[model samples]
Target: MDKTLRRWAPLFVVPALICFIIAFLVPMIMGLVLSFFKFSTVTDGVFVGWSNYKRIFTDMDFISSLWMNVRFTIVTVFTINIFAFFLALLLTRGVKGTNVYRTIFFMPNLIGGIVLGWIWLLIINGILLPKGVTIISDPKYGFWGLVALANWQNIGYMMVIYIAGIQTINRDLIEAAQIDGANSWIRLKSVILPSVMPAITICTFLTLTSGFKIFDQNLALTAGNPARKTEMLALNIYNTFYTRTNFEGVGQAKAVLFTILVAVIALTQLAATRQKEVEA
Candidate 1:
């Protein structure tokens, strides 16, 4: 049976492998190659060496967007995870109506990013309209507005993961700590936190990548208003690719850099968190 299964597994794997190659691997390789060329389309690419990348570095908008995204990612990563973890702790403590609350919290994540952005836009502007300003009136306003939207959309999803992690914890270990005269804070530090490290790792990676790749919300909410101050990396890449002429290669290059940045940051986070994860 084992030999037969092994033999037939390749037959099942081959189709998916082919699909992956055609759908992802091919396009990815093409994108990397195209980044070094000037072209409006894949077929017309003219070799331009590293000129596209050089343009990206010299572009002030790209630099500003990069820094803006960095700041946004940092703030969201810490804020989203902290709130999610606390909420997870609360819900896991035999709270009544927990299922209802969880559903309500997570429903926001089910909303489309564009739609969610518009929803928040109205809500935020309603508050600021009285002050004769709007979310797009100031870069700081847009920045914090994005932060709020991110937290609202992500916290519940992260909470669900945290709850799952918290549930997996050995009650015996917690009880042992309590019997050892460990206080709640100490038990959390020594046991609960370490036990949930896997969940923390997953949540952190998701938030980090999402923060960096954010586009639809950035577009719908601020549209990089106030002279493009709120533009993020993804939006910047989009504007470069579609809004500007003869800059497709530059946009593609920006995309490659963005991918590399996200990959490196996410991998580093995973490595750091995995080292601290305790056996459950």
Candidate 2:
């Protein structure tokens, strides 16, 4: 039976492998190739070498968008994880209606990003209208709006993961800490945190990547208004691709670079956090 199953495994895998190559691998390879060329279309592409890369760095909007995304990622990752962890801790306690509270918190994540963006747009505008400001009226407003939206959508999901992690911790370990003259703070710091380091690592990684790659929310919320001050790296690439008729190649180049940047950051974060998990 083992020999027969092993022989059939390659046949079962072949179709999925072919689909993967066609759906993802081919486009990815083509995108990489096209990044080095100047063209509005694949058929009309002209090999331009590093000029696209050069333009990406020289363009002030691209640089600004990149920095904005970095800032947003940093803020969102830290805030979301901290808030979620605390919420998870609270919910895991012997609180009434904890399941209902979890469901309520998580409902926002089930909403589509585009719908969420629009909903927040109206809600924020309603609040700011009284204050004589709007999300698109200024970059600062847009930035805060994005942060709020991200926190609302992601915190609950992260909380769920954290709750699972907290529950998995051995009850005796916590009891032992308590009996060892450890206060609540000490027990939390030395016992609970170390045991849940894996969950922290996972949550951090998810938030980092999601925050960096955010596009639909950025688009529907601000559309990079007020001279594109609120533009993020994803939106910048999109505008370069479709909005500017002559810069498709540059846009593709930006996308390729953005992909590389995200890959590097995510891998570094994972490696660092994984090391912490191992140590813990």
Model 1 per-residue lDDT tens digits across residues 69-185: 999999999999999999999898788999999899888999889998999899889989989998877899899989999999999999999999999999899999999999999
Best candidate according to TM-score:
2
Root-mean-square deviation (CA) per prediction: 2.4, 1.9
Which runs in model 2 stand beyond 4 Å of their true positions?
1-11, 273-280
TM-score to true structure, per model: 0.91, 0.94
- What value of lDDT does candidate 2 attain over all alpha carbons? 0.91
